[model samples]
Target: MCGIVGAVAQRNIVPILLEGLKRLEYRGYDSCGVAVNNGGLKRARSVSRVAELERQVDDSGFAGNTGIAHTRWATHGVPATNNAHPHFSARDGEQRIGLVHNGIIENYEEIRTELKALGYVFESQTDTEAIAHLVNHMYDGDLLSTVQKAVKRLHGAFAIAVFAKDEPQRIVGARLGCPLIVGLCDNENFLASDAMALAGSTDQIIYLEEGDVVDVRLDGVRIYDRDDQPVERRVQTVQAYSGAIELGPYRHYMQKEIFEQPRAISDTLEGVLGFAPDLFGPKAQDVFADIDSVLILACGTSYYSGMTAKYWLESLANLPTSVEIASEYRYRKPAVNPKALVVVISQSGETADTLAALKYAKELGHRHSLSICNVGTSAMVRETELSYLTRAGAEIGVASTKAFTTQLTALFLLTATLAKMRGKLDAEAEAFYLKSLRHLPTALQSVLALEPHIIAWSEAFARKENALFLGRGLHYPIALEGALKLKEISYIHAEAYPAGELKHGPLALVTEEMPVVTVAPNDTLIEKLKSNMQEVRARGGQLYVFADGDSQMSSSEGIHVIRLPEHYGLLSPILHVVPLQLLAYHTALARGTDVDKPRNLAKSVTVE
Candidate 1:
């Protein structure tokens, strides 16, 4: 998940480029660099943070009116100064081309062999270096045409920004599989992998489509389609949330986001008055009428949200459902039902594997597709026939909190809509579900009040090396999510298993040193879950349980219980997950780890 920013402007662009990279830092990166054309290609790169790169630029007196910058998440080489972005293509002892790229090149080995045979030498172990050399080799007095011809030979996904030493006032950009956007300002033009990079600088943004090439100049911009035909793209105005990116009173973005859940769910359910198929889209009524089953596709946290929805959809809507990891779904041929409604979930909507899976599903003749996402203008939204936009705002934390809850809120709405369409819900049932949804914000507030108790538990957890999470029935996915959050931010080895599955194998790993966390909602499985807890306690395993107020669970010699305010029967997963998030957050803080920007992880997985 790399980031790219480029600008053709009249003023010094180094500050703008550096600030853009800062905004994109949440996407995750290992190294950063910038290249400027001040009569010649002047570049600086570092494997350290962006702040260090800025210091190096200032010390070297680096300044330019036109430039390209990159924050790279390494895929082809090790994270080192040489592997950093803004890679160069030198000719006759002069760096002629400076290029920054996102995404991978599948046929780089073949291209590199051909380029090497043509006497082109590579200095970095990256697939992107091949593109730079190919561009330099194809330069015939025009940077735009040279890049256009070079990208035609590329075999895999890429979004690139390149500047030529001879064409100091111009920058060429192209996108195939990854995202790219153009920002418009007075006598200035910009290119970035994300519109957030140009938030304060420009409000007018143009999202480029697949296989589009853009040429940016100080006065204007030009675009070309895949077939070499000149084209015009619509420019839309975007309101930048300047205040949302700041950490106000909160220690980290993760903490602020965790506290923001109540408002996020409220915003996501803002306009809902009652259940209706049209809540999803204008065509939802027809789509719901035709579908016989549901197929959910996603990855990581989104996949877990789908797993929770499986219980909601099957039990409430009486529809058969299946959830698949998006990355694995596209690799093998599977039975595709033409009538099955395909639902894809993601927060950023730019997740590479999920987007690819959506395309693959369409190619396999799936007639109906829907996207539940936070970003309204993302590629997944554009590719699908219907979409539900979750108003979770901007999730800056690499470990998701508000986004995950907001997704569950959206999926629940979908379940209710389908239930209503199938005539399974009468007036009384509809009113009850609506009242429960309206009261979710208040319920979430009550759960947040339990943070002080969770913080006390976090101290004991921070000293441990491993954790085990258990749940039954509908809460099993919540247990998986809890384990994922613990391992993701706190860097602790954690695992989750269904309560019934513990005796099968996971119980052998239980001991006094292991902390077993359980989600005990007051559901039909409570008695069965009690038996599972007995098994854990009998094995001398320390237990930390999050139970509903009426579950009748209490703290004892080896058992530590934190009671939730109430039991939300159908929506308990959404409420049960908040404490686990807090447990992970405070644990990471106690361990002195980077809670916001965890090591080796990015907020958005834009590349496979």
Candidate 2:
């Protein structure tokens, strides 16, 4: 996935383009470039960060009222200056167009062959470069018509922004499977792959649907459908704040987001004094009445959240539930229960595989669909009939922290609401659940107080090459999440197993060199989990147990313990995950690895 930003304004728009790209750099940050239509065309490309792109532009002293910029996470080409975006198309002496694109163009090779036969030569090894040449070849001095024609010939996911030197006051954009938006301002107009890029300049945004072409000018904007008819789309205001992207006094975004858990969880639980079906959406009660089972679709951290919710949905609501990795779910033609409720979880709400999986579920005759997401304007939210928005503000870290916790909070609320509707909860039981939720912010703060202890463990963990995490019941998903964090940020090879399943196979990997992180939650499975820890000890493995105060596990010869203040009952996963996040962050800090933008990972996986 890549980030694209375009601007057409009465004043110079170079600053706006650069700042917008800076905000959207979390989507992709391998290389970046910007093209400006200043009388002729002026461009600067970089093989490094956005700051380097800005410096290159400054050193060249480029300025224009119309511009398009890109920050790329390389897919078709390697990360280099020539492979950077804002690709150009010019004849021997003629300059006509420059384009920035997000998403893959599946039919580029075929088009490139035709263009090459027609006397067009390519300068870079990118699918996006072909688009610029094709648009230039089809240009009849009408940029809108040319872009519309070029998009029709292409096949695959794309959100493209194009600018012509002849038509310097206009920018044309088109979208198919990826996201694109038009930002409205007083005397200016903007386009970006994400609405978060427009938060600083304008909150008013119009989301472009699939196969919609947009023509933006300094005065206004016009939307066109696939059949060349004009269409009117409603403008919506985005609630995200620009300040959330700032990392105030923190070393990395993961650290800042980890510390923001209390506020993020509180914002997610704002108006919920008691549980009700309307907490999700107006149609939630009716949907819950007909569905006898639940099927959750998600990927990466969101999939783990779905796994955690499967536990809650089955144990609390007494409903059958299944979780599937979205990428794998979409490919296999599995048996589907028509009455099952399909729930999709995504932090960005734009993950391509998850969206495809949701579509597949709907095509298989599942009528009711719901999305648990963070972004309101994303494709998943638009496709689902009912949805719950997680209020975790802009997550800049490639490794997720607050988004996972907030998803758990929202899913827990969904569980309680479903339980109430099914008559599984009495008035006193509902009141107790509400009270526990009200106390969650304080409980989270208490867990955050254990960071010093986690940091000490991280110091020793930094020296180790591998780790094993063990848990049972609902806490098993929490252990999976912990291992994922360590591998994502710290680059430590880690594996997680249900404590009962260790004897089946994973126990063979345990040794003195392997640090075994155990989640002993003082619940019904505590005895079984403790026995698993003993299995690790008998094999000469070191133990780091996050146990409850009354579990009686302490610092012994081979056993090390950090006892929590109190056990949080059903909400223990929400509390137990904080220290693991801290462990990953501090361990990455000790190992001198890039914590925020881990290698080969982007904050949002908008491509398949």
Largest TM-score belongs to which candidate? 1
lDDT of 1 at 363: 94
Residue 175 of model 2: what lDDT? 94
- Across 112-174, the per-residue lDDT of candidate 1 in tens digits comes to 999999989888899999999989989988999998999999988999999999998899999
Q: For each candidate, what is the lDDT?
A: 0.94, 0.90
Shift of residue 591 alpha carbon in model 2, Å: 1.2
Residue 303 lDDT, candidate 1, scale 0-100: 97
Report the C-alpha lDDT of model 2 over 322-388, residue by residue, as the tens digit.
Answer: 9999999999998989888899999999999999999999898999999999998899999997899
Q: What is the alpha-carbon lDDT of model 2 when measured against the actual structure? A: 0.90
